[model samples]
Target chain A: EDQVTQSPEALRLQEGESSSLNCSYTVSGLRGLFWYRQDPGKGPEFLFTLYSAGEEKEKERLKATLTKKESFLHITAPKPEDSATYLCAVQEAKSSYKLIFGSGTRLLVRP
Target chain B: SAVISQKPSRDICQRGTSLTIQCQVDSQVTMMFWYRQQPGQSLTLIATANQGSEATYESGFVIDKFPISRPNLTFSTLTVSNMSPEDSSIYLCSVEDTREQYFGPGTRLTVT
Candidate 1:
């Protein structure tokens, strides 16, 4: 079975604090790993797509790195605006583009 | 990225009533999907709306309970039939562009 798990279900960080959220997956064949940020009362916004191990992507204060069995979303000097539920999903190589998502990690950056 | 929009951002309906949600994408897309997000839960795909064909429902989901219609490449609708309190959730529409998927604002439904 394909499954995705995210650790540290909830995190409270002071403004300018740095932390990393973890996503571990067990899939038949890894096709793609995606990260999304969802705010209250809004839908998810795309963040990054990591396709292979050792791949990394960054945007402003956020950086995402991938490994064979897991992925990490690192937030550097996060601000209050960066507070949101971060979601992780994985696509199986043999499946028809369907995504299996994790429970998500809620981060609160207090100012 | 494709921009998606859903109608009725939030609604409160009584049990036994039905509600239909519409989804429109900025550009034509080959694949569209409907998902349900329960409070504090991750998104679960309800069905895949294929243009000019019957929608493909996921396991544990049926067409009679949640009917989907894909009239064209950029528009689709999902109707939640015989609503119940357990059906209260955020319904989202997503479109696949190339290798990535983009979601709409979502419809927040509250059933009484």
Candidate 2:
């Protein structure tokens, strides 16, 4: 069965603190890994997509790296505005355009 | 990225009633997806709506309980039948644009 597990259910960091969230996935065949940020009472916003091992993508203050079995979302000098639930999902190579999502990590950057 | 919008951002309905949520995209898309996000849980794909075809529902979901309609390439609707406390969730619609899916604001439903 394909499954996704995210570590550190919740994290509280002071402003400017940097950390990384982990997403471990088990799939029949890896196709793509995605990262999204969701705010309270809102829908998820697309962040990045990593397709192969050693692939990395970065935004303003966020960086996502992918490997054979897992992915990591690293936040650098996170501000309060960046506080949101970070979600990770994976697509199986053999399946159609469907995504299996993780429980997500609730991040709070306190000012 | 496609710009998506959902109607009736939030609503409170009585049990056994029904609610229909609408999703519209700025551009034409071949595939539109509906997802359910329970409180504190991850998003789960309910069904995939394709233009000119029956919606493909995922396992643990049924067409009778959750019917979907794809009238055109840019619009779709998901109706929650027989609402219950378990049906209280955030319903989101997304469009596939070049391997990336963009989501709408979502409709928050509360069943009482």
Candidate 3:
């Protein structure tokens, strides 16, 4: 069975604090790993997609790195606006455009 | 990136009533999906809306309970039938383009 697990169910960080959220997965064949940020009462917003084990992607204050068994979303000097639930999902190579999502890590960056 | 929009941002319905949510994408997408999120829970895919064909439902979801319609490439609808308090959730629609998926704002449904 393909499964995705995200650790640190909830995190409270002061403004400008740096932190990393973890996502571990078990799948038949890894096709793609996705990162999304969802605000309260809204749907998720697309962040990054990592396809290979050694791949990494970055935005302004966010960086995502991938490994064979896990993935990390590193937040640098996060602001209160960065507070949101971060979601991780994986696509199985054998599946047809379907994503298996993790429980997600709720982040709060207090100012 | 594609921009997706959903109608009826939020609604409160009585038990046994039904509600339909609409999703519209800015551009034509090859794949579209519907998902449900309970309070503080992660997303659960309900079905894949395929244009010109019947929607493919997930394991726990059924066509009779959640009917989906994909009449074109950029628009789709998801109807929650026989609503109950358990059906209160945020329903989201996503479009897959290339290898990335973009989501809409979502419809917040409150069943009472």
Q: Pick by lDDT: which candidate is best?
A: 1
lDDT of 1 by residue, B18-97 (tens): 99999999999999999999998999999999999999998999999999999999999999999999999999999989
Inter-residue clash pairs, candidate 1: none
Which of candidates 1 and 3 reaches a greater DockQ?
3
Each model's fnat?
0.63, 0.83, 0.80
Q: What interface root-mean-square deviation (Å) does model 3 yield? A: 0.6
RMSD of each: 0.8, 0.8, 0.9
Question: Candidate 2: lDDT of A8?
Answer: 87
Chain A TM-score across all models, in listed order: 0.98, 0.98, 0.98
Candidate order, DockQ descending = 2, 3, 1
Q: How much lDDT does each candidate structure score? A: 0.95, 0.95, 0.95
lDDT of 3: 0.95
Tens-place lDDT per residue, model 2, A1-111, is 999999889999999999999999999898899999999999999999899999999999999999999999999999999999999999899976899999999999999
Lowest lDDT sum, 10 consecutive residues, model 2 chain A, at A90-99
lDDT of 2 at A89: 94
Q: Could you give candidate 1's per-residue lDDT for residues A20-56 as a string of tens digits?
A: 9999999989989999999999999999999999999
Ranking by lDDT: 1, 3, 2
